[model samples]
Target: MDCDVLVVGAGAVGAVAALGLRRQGYRVRVLDAGQPMEAPTGEAIDPRVFALSPASIELLESLDLWPRLAPRAQGYAGMTVWDAVSGSDIRFRAAEFGLDGLGAIVENAALVSAAQAALDDVEFGAALAAVDETTDAVTVTTDDGRPVRARTLLLADGANSPGRQALGIAVSGRGYGGRAIVCHLRSERGHDVTAWQRFLPSGPVALLPLFDGRVSLVWSADDALADRLLALDDAAFSDAVTEATAGRLGALHTPTRRFAFPLRRQTAERFTTRRCVLLGDAAHVVHPLAGQGVNLGFDDLRALLVAMPDPDVGLRAAALRRYERARRADIAQMSQGIDGLDRLFSTANPAVSTVRGFGLHLADVVTPLKRRFAEVALGVKPGFPSASG
Candidate 1:
């Protein structure tokens, strides 16, 4: 089993990476230990949804996968965020940026399914048993006793990537003593095409709109609170969520089954070694408060593809190092920024609260600075590939 590139995960990021490489005429083979995601159906919103940035949307469009997902996506025209304790609120409108919306929210499974459909083949339930790298190529052994050879092996298997560990790549991260609670809820007031977030002392709570008049909930809570909330019955949990959100959308109810995952900050010490390289969560995992986890993964694909557009060029260590260096700085900046903001909000000191409030208000009133922030968040600024191209 030899190919141009071997993608070690079939999730949205890995699938999209494989699709992009294929578009560049690479004979790509994707291997995943998990089963393929089924196409979503029915009226209910998938509990796992991603707020796709403009750059992510463009990446999908460039790969010709956005059209398959567009009808199922919900576009938010504005974003409203406030501090639960300080009463400081900031709103960003799409009209202000002359864009239709801030971003599109699509189910995670749907995006992967769409990307899978575009691929020629993906080896499902194929756990990687071992990896052997050489100067010119890499050989991967699967659980089924099959061997795969490729010029480059993309280890996008996620945060706790086995490939990275097998190759002895170190990672530095710490548990944030918090867990994210995710679910879908029906709000009393319409979401109004606005993505709302309220930063509580424990963590931030986001109510992202869905296409079917519902909103997805992402509550980052302290570990104990998360356990307590999850232990409650559905009705009680919904009430807790409504209270936590201050009923901004009137009242939230009809919550789907809740899901929770521990929050942490992780960064791979090295992004590449030999003929293998890390991508997406495999390289870094940041706070979910900003909803940029998957977006960062897409950016990884964009950077890697741009650096080495063709597989035939071979996966050179120098090229991989360039991609690693380029992404490390941006990842560090985002990781630090989000961590700093989380710490700032977590503090209960009145003086810190006042300073934070003032900063949010100042950014809101300053048009140039606000637009610059928006551009950075949307990934439409310079240094990224455009859909038009």
Candidate 2:
């Protein structure tokens, strides 16, 4: 009936946030409405794996989620970005950045399951009926007709957050004519735990190698192509993906059932309203080209934990404003950069293609610039979660 902190949503961000707050000496309660998805996102395998940056790993590690996740995780010591249409690509080595690995490829459901297991206690299947903010505390009523009272409420409900709306927080976002086709595929050669991304005329295709001989695919393509791929049978679909990706993985075979989600950019104008604060997808959503959506959520987790006030309401409006302002530029830069990259590479013009190819080659040749990217991708150059320098 009551808790020191109440988190709505048991997805990636919400689970992590609840665990973080609980570890901070607060009595935390989590409410999740969706049936906890088990065994990944497909019949054959889970295609919804995440490329966890070092920052995310560190955050989870601190919460003791990484150790439980290590057995299932696939680590990449480097990453390669190539232009499929043009023979241009850039290689990023973790060694160049003085890190052990570029990042880790983690199955999505596995991650939350691990995080929840590490947590002391978390309640599921309770839909939040209402969230009412008061001067001193916030009261949340659940579908089961139970009122969960908390000194502070964190809403991590997700991109199209009902919690944000119920709490009267203003959110802003717009859709891009892009959809991502995701699935798992087997390769002849081992990926060596390396992450690969190729930018095509339509959009970007990312191949994150898993522990086994398979790789999870995230292909951001145009609307029409997405529909076609979603409709294709398993056999035909594999061939289409391979052709679109140009057989980069030495022939992608055995594609599991595919799923697609619309792409969009969303950012809440106000991070905090009254006693409730927005975190994760509740705050913003960015293009997945750079794989920054969950990474942004990790950033939110770190910021809130590090800056939480003594009392839940101790978070001053000015401080919350500062946090929102600080995050705006980074989120905006990533959204604009990814959106621009999609626009630049999605064109069919000969001139634009030629220039983009040349730019890729330029990045490949520049050692310093390439290393900088490696550091950023490792998620530890600076301003990352907890790891410094």
Candidate 3:
């Protein structure tokens, strides 16, 4: 099989990348080892949810998907973040940035469904076995003994991308020494469509609002503490979560089965090798305290689409090089910012805590600076890609 672009990994990012490229008039083919996403059996929200930035929403809108997802998505007009250690807090509002909402929270499955629906075909159950890049095309061998070739191969296989490894790419990563425990819970008080986060010595705890009036909880805990928390019964876990949030939303109860994953800061040494390029977690994976992991992926698609606006010309070395240079700076900046925040908040030093708290307080009071910060987080920037780009 051959195409203008071969996208390996049909996850949300990979699927979106393929669809986006196809929209740009590229003959794109997607290969994935994962099963097709199943429709939700009921109205119960999936435990995994992503905070979709305005940029991401725009990208989805360009594909005519936001309308389908809007009914199920929960939009937050504001966010409040505070430090548990120093009791300092900062608040951000969409109104401050002249936007109706900061972002929308949508389930992972929902996004996959939306992106997948936009695509005409995705080769499910197709695991990559080998990748061989030639002077003209990247040839791939599937696990089932099939050969495929393309002018450009996109490796969106995720943080541990086999496609990246096949190209001898290296990654630098360090564990945050914490695990995030995620679940959905009902609160005694309304969430008021606000996303809340509190930084503790261990990690940050976020309570993101949902459309159904429940909140999604993301508690990043130290490994030992996470173990203990995971061992607790459902009621006990709910009690702990309620206490952790300081009962801000009143009491949180009826938590769904909790999910925990180790947190890490990872980035590939390079984003491109020959005709194969990395996207999403394949290129970078940062601490999730900011909930920008997937958003960064969308930006990857955006940058690629912008740099290589013409498919025929996009497969060239110059276009690939342009894409590499375009995305690296933004990815690096975000990676550093998240890494710095993780390290800063994880520090137990009293002096650092005081300084951090003071900084938060100062930012809260400084209107222009606060708006700038909000804009940055919303993924609206000077070089953001338009639908045409």
Candidate 4:
């Protein structure tokens, strides 16, 4: 085999995967169709950011990548979620859980840069064209007709993964018929280092605190509303956001460019074949209502690493099966929970809204229940009983 493992995609997850495997003394080859993202410069922040759980932070620290990301990461100590229609709210504090913060918000480009910097050999502009798997090794043919072979294949190519398609893996789920608009805005008041989210009938709008006074906004809305919001001028759009969030952070202004992507809930029929395993968005896509998308991907990587501590046995079918079994339940539970919340909040029914509001209220006051939710968010607890099977 050309290498111990061939990673097809150098996004945050893929690059980090390569870094982790290389640290374990494995010969790993990484391929990506695009060049590495340039590190963010100046005062501007990349609109694409992730809320990294403690578990994810631990993984990055273990791989010696956290030092690079820590400078730019912004930690949030509390989170407040509320219902716009029913005026119900729930708050979570890291202090309540005996932690400094729930999670840190890190820009995507920064993470990619850090991971890429830690790894010496990531072949950019190389795309996977074909895959030939056998009993012992998996070989990939690049679009340029270059052949790359490995003991096993790791597909982190993303939700629309060509690697997954090449393996004839099928993903099943429907789009939410909505899009999430993300950008940075300067709020009049400080965010108090709190992550704020309000569920409108259309969707959920989140304002995550940044190191700077500005907040990162992720507003998930239905198609029509999304189009309308995107069509508005900067002032009007910012005003709409202020209204949607009920002026929680005061009048928002100085908005950055807005970008939106369609929402979907997808899961691969299977996470592993005989010699190849899928990771990150390649295996599952969840709604962004909970800001757990990238974190789930990190969780996937951590589980795979734990299952495959030694490359000698890690490439075997049994180890791959162990990784798959450990992750599927957590991913499914998170996907279903986020999808359910999206559906629940998207409804305009008076009765259902009232009930959900009451549920949120109850969850807020119930210490044990709230603690459990916090544990899941922190990634300290898995959605299933055995996250490490």
Candidate 5:
């Protein structure tokens, strides 16, 4: 065999997976169809960012990637979520849960650069052309007619993973008919190291604090509204954001380019097949309302490592089964919960709005329930079985 494991894709998850597996004494090779990610330039921040949970931070620390990202990452000590229609809001603080902060906001490019720097080598420009799985091993052919064999293959490509399609793995989900707009804004008032989100009829709008005193905005709006918002000039767009957020951060001004991407929730039919398996976005894609998509992918990596402690027995059917079972429930629950929130908030029905308002208010006042929500967000109490189970 060319290696013990072949990781397809060199994104944050795939690079980290390869590093983890290699540290476990497994020979690992990584393949990516695109060139290596370039480091962020100048003082401008990438619009693509992720709110990484504590569990995810630990994973990165374990891989020694956190040190590189620590300088750039911003920790939000509190979060406030509200309903635009009902005027109901719920607030959470890390101190309430005996923690210093809730999570860290890191730019996507920074994460990719850090992971890639740690990765020994990656075969960029090599796409998976075909996969031939057997009882003992799996062999993958690249687009350039190169063949690579390994005891197992992991697909960490994005949601529309070509590697997954090549394996005939089907995904199930629906488009949200909306697009998420992301950009950094300069706020007149300080963010106070807080993350604020308000649910509107269009969708949810979030203002996440950045390390450099700027706020990263993620506004999910319906297709038509999103198009109109994107068409606005910088000043007009900033005004729209201020209005959407109810002027929570005072007058906001855009200092960077805006980006928008379609929203969708998808899950693969299965997480594994014979000697092949799916990880990260390849296995699941959840709505970004809760900013848990990337965190969930990190969870998948953690579970896979736990399920297969021994390289010799890790890729076996039993081990793979354990990993799949452990992750499916968590992913399904999160996806469904976020989708329900999206639906609940996107409606103009008076009765529905009233009930959701009351629900949010109740969750805010109920200490125990609010604590539970914080724990789940921190990944301290994963609502799924462990690998040993």
Candidate 6:
């Protein structure tokens, strides 16, 4: 098999797909733009972090990638959500969901490295130049000059996937007028092995507990404020963080590595095109309010492998219709949910606050409903998977 599955973008999603696909008895090849030119491979830690769903953990565990990630990753028992203005709060625990841990707070670099190291088959440093879907198969070319054909092409190149565009997939994007400013901060108080998200008018400020006495923070704010915060000195930064989060984590001090990215709601017009399928960020990118972006990608990885044929497409129509149909509701629901949350807490009006706070209060008082909510938010509950129906 020259190429059983060709994956574009060797990021965490692409690496995981390559490993999982190869292990499922499919030959796989991966291509990346060679971040080595801009970022040293030795110190290649993606500043962004991810919250691995429990199902995602199971998949990683089965693939033997979890153990490799465990050393560099930190596990959280639960998360707390609050309002920066009104202080309306809701807490979800692993125990409430009948799980040992709510989820894992993993550095993006750690997951990428674990995913990469777990794969023995991949072609890094090769950015994709072209993707053509023929009558029978898909052909891919790389910048460093490597061409391969696979019966099925997996587009994991991320939100700005050029391969997706080259294949003429109409990707529509909508922005929330916000940016995610991320950095780590040393804490005086224990994050108590817990994750925290406070919804403010600017955006959300999440404090995910890390190894040692520190936490990784992603402060999504209006674009202008995010730019100014990124430029603040260490003392000013910490002071702002303390005030914004209501000093819950306590005595915050900004750690090294500060960065920001535009926030948006974008999805491809078609998730699958003939022999080509888009997965991971290539398919959709939503607000990081839920932190389910990569977990959603992992779900795709699992479903695609489960839906693959005995060998390859091999005159088969790829069964991608089944994949698309099975996954659409879940994707649509989540996209809308995130958009609603973005709007809910982003307005500065008092009427909006009162209504939203009352809703949160009602949710807090409702026991069974709250448990169900925890199950979904913490990624413990079995979701509507592409293979479920």
lDDT of 2 by residue, 131-245 (tens): 8877767898888888889877888888878888887777677887879888888876677678888888888888888866688889998899888788888888878767766
lDDT (Cα, tens digit) per residue for candidate 6, span 1-389? 35767778878788888887777677677777755212213333456878887878878887888887786667887788888666798887677556677778877777786677666545667788888788678888877667788877888889989889899889777887878888878887989988898999888889887765578888888879988898889899988988888899788985667888888889888888888888989998888888888988887877776777445442255577777775778778777777777788887789889887887787688877665555445545623222232
lDDT of 2 at 127: 84
- Write candidate 4's Cα lDDT for 267-339 as tens digits: 9999998889999999998888788878889888988888788777787778889999999898888777677
Q: Candidate 5's residue-wise lDDT over 1-389, tens digit each?
A: 99989999998788888888877778889999999887776677888999987778878888888999989999887899899999998898776666666789999899988787788589899999999999889999999999999989999988998889999999999999899999999999999999899999889999999989999999999899999998999999999999999999899996589899989999999999878889999999887888887888888998989887878778677887888899899888878777777888888789999998998889898977675555444343433222221
**The candidate that achieves the highest lDDT relative to the unseen native structure:** 4
Q: What is the per-residue lDDT of model 1 for residues 1-389, given as tens digits with 9 covering 90 to 100?
A: 38878999988889999988888888889999998788899775678899988778988988889899998999887888888778888888876766656788999988988888788588899998889999988999998999999888999999989899888899998989899999999999999999898888888899999988899999999988998999999889889989988999998898898999889999999888878889999999988888888988988888888777665454677778778877888888878877876887887788988988887788789877565555444443422235422
Model 1: which residue pairs collide? none
For model 4, state the Cα shift of residue 193 in Å. Answer: 0.5
Best by TM-score: 4
Residue 166 in candidate 4, Cα distance off native in Å: 0.5
Q: lDDT per residue, candidate 3, 278-305, as tens digits? A: 9999999988888998999998998899
Predict model 1's lDDT versus the native. 0.84
Off by over 4 Å in 1: 312-314, 368-389
Assess candidate 3 and give its TM-score to the true structure.
0.95
Which candidate model has the greater lDDT, 1 or 3? 3
Off by over 4 Å in 5: 371-389
Q: What's the CA error at residue 14 for candidate 5, in Å?
A: 0.8
lDDT score, candidate 4, position 65: 91
**Higher-ranked by TM-score: 2 or 4:** 4
TM-score for candidate 4: 0.96
Candidate 1's error at 388, in angstroms? 9.8
Question: Considering summed lDDT, which 10 consecutive residues are worst modelled in model 4?
Answer: 380-389
